[model samples]
Target: MNYPFCIRCGWVLALTFASCYPGLAQTPTPARDTSFTVYSALAKARKTDPSITLARPAVPTIIRSRMNVPYCTASGRALQLDVFYPKARRQGGYPAVLLIHGGGWRSGDRSQHVPMAQQLAARGFVAVTAEYRLSTEAPYPAAVQDLKAAVRWMRANARTYRINPKQIATWGFSAGGQLAALVGTTNEETRFDSLACNIGYSSQVQAIVDVDGILAFIHPESGEGDDRKSTSAATYWFGSPKTERPDLWRQASALTYVGPHTPPTLFLNSSVDRMHAGRDDMMRQLSQFNIYHEVHTFPDAPHPFPLFNPWFSPTLDYTVAFLNKVFSRK
Candidate 1:
C-alpha cells in the first residue's frame, strides 16, 4: 500500500498512527552543507565593512564551564550543549539564558555563541550554548524541538548547574533569534515539545532576546521566499519555497504564536529593515497584552552585529539589562 506523505517535510502520513502519536514521524534528513560558522559570518560581514572582527571565545577565570553535555537524543543522535556559570553563585541560583547561533538555518553551530555565553556566565547568569539540528539534517520543527528539549534539560538539571529554572531566557542571533523568539512565545505549548526528552520538565522561558531575527516568514516585510536568483535559506529549511509550502512557513513563524501569554522580549536589531519583519506587529500584540518589551536598533550596524566588537559589547549590555529587568520582577 502506498502511504500518503507530507510534501513539505517529506514525512509519511500514516494517518491512523500520526493522529495517535504526533511525534512518531520524524522529519526526513536532507543533504546540505553545514559549513557556515562565526569565521564565515565575520568574513562576509568584513566584506561589507572591513572594520568588523569575529568575537573570540574567552573563558574567564571567574567562569566555570561543562563542555559537550548531552541534553537530549533525537532521531538516534545525541544533541549536546555547553554550560557556562559563575564561580560565585547567587543566593537563589543564577538566572539562565540559552544562546543560539544564526546561520540561515542551514549552517552555524552552538560554538558560535561561546564568547557571549562566557560573558553572560561571568556576569552572573548560567548561560547555555546549544546545538540544534540544522536544515541540512532535519527541517523546520526539528530545530524548534531540539531547542525546547534543551530548555527542558536545563530545568531538569537546574540544581546541578545552579540555575533558577523559573528565570530562564532564550537568546538567538539571526536564524537563532527567530528560533529564540518562537521558543519564548510558544511557552507551555506542548505540541513543540519532544516526548523523548525530560518529559516532566517545562520548556517555558521568562524572557526572549532576538538579535536581528526575522519574526515572520510570510509577513509583508519578509524577504524569505524571494528566491529568483537562487534557493533561499527559508526554502532550504522548509524543504519547499514559501509559495509552495506557505503553511509550513506560517507555522514556523514566531509571530503566528504571539498572544497574551507571550513573555517579555528584547529586540536588538540592525539597520536592515527586512530582519525586523513581524517585530512591530509582535510588539503591538505584546503591548495589547500589557507585557514588557524593548526594541533598540543600531544606526548602521550589519545583520551580524552581535558577532563583532563595536556592536557586540552593546548587544551584550542590552541583553543583560533586559534579562535582569524581566527576572528582577519575578
Candidate 2:
C-alpha cells in the first residue's frame, strides 16, 4: 500500500490558496515539477533489477507512422496524436488501439508509448499515441475528454488511416490506464464528450487494457488522497483532498460506471497490490453481465514493467492476444 508521492506539499498549498481566492483562480497555475519520464522510470527499475533497460522507439519499414497529427482543439490548445499503421492494408480496415502513457496525470507524453505503437502497427493493427492536457494544464475530466476526442478522431478519419471504426480499443499504462477505463466504460455518456472535434463521431472503444492503474480513487485499497503525509497525484488532479471533495473522487472512478454496457477489459498488473484497487469489484460486475475480462500479474515486477524488457514482451503479447480475441483479428 506504499506508493511514491509525486506532488510536493507547497504545490498543494498554492492550489488551496487559488481555490479560496476567486480573483487568484483566474491567474494561471504554475506547473509542478514532474520528472516522471521513460528514462526516469527505467532508472528506478534498474535499481531493483540491473537487467532491466529502457525500451527505445523505432519505426519499422513495414510500419508507417504520422507524427504530431492534430486530433482536437481543447482549452484553447490543439491536442495532437501520433499514428502508426501497417503498410499493407486489409480488405476493409484493421483493428486500432489507442496507446495512452502514464505519469500520474501530470508528466509523461505521447512519445512515451511510441515503441509500443510501432510494434502494434507491425503486428497488423493501427496504433495511435495521443497527448492530453495534464493536471498542470487542466484537471480531471479534461484528460478524459481529450482521450475520447482522440477516439472520435480515429473514427472520423477511418478511411485515411485504414482503421476499422468498430474495432477501436484503448490501451493505457498507470494513470492513462485509469483514463482508458473511464472512457471505455462511459461510452455515449454526453458528459465526457467534447464538441471540439469530430462532433458527430462516436468516442466509444470496444475493449480496454489497464496496466497497473487504480480503478477507484477512494476505494479501500486506494492510496490516493493521503495528504496527511504528502500530496498525492490524485489530490492534485482533483484540486482537493479526498476528505474535502469525496464527490469528485468517487465521480472520477471508472468503477462508478462499470455496468452491462462496459466493454471487455484486460488487466496487466505488477505485483503491487494497491495498484489493483477496485479491480476485484469490477471483475465481479463484469461476471454478472457475462462480459469477458482477463488478468495477468507479473511476480515482483515494478509498476512500470511495460517500459522494460523482461515484462514488455509479455505485455505486448498479452495485449495483442486480448485485442485479437475481442476484435476477431488474426
For model 1, the stretches where C-alpha displacement exceeds 4 angstroms are 1-32
Error of 2 at 185 (Å): 0.6
TM-score to true structure, per model: 0.89, 0.92
Residue-level lDDT tens digits of model 1 in 35-73: 566676688788888988777646689989999999999
lDDT of 2 at 73: 90
Task: Show the colliding residue pairs in model 1.
Answer: none
As a whole number from 0 to 100, the lDDT of residue 36 in candidate 1 is: 63
List, residue by residue over 281-309, the lDDT tens digit for candidate 2: 99999999999999999999999999888
In angstroms, the error of model 2 at 200 is 0.6
Q: Assess each prediction's global lDDT (C-alpha) against the native.
A: 0.83, 0.84
Which 10-residue window in model 2 sums to the lowest lDDT? 20-29
- Index of the highest-TM-score prediction: 2
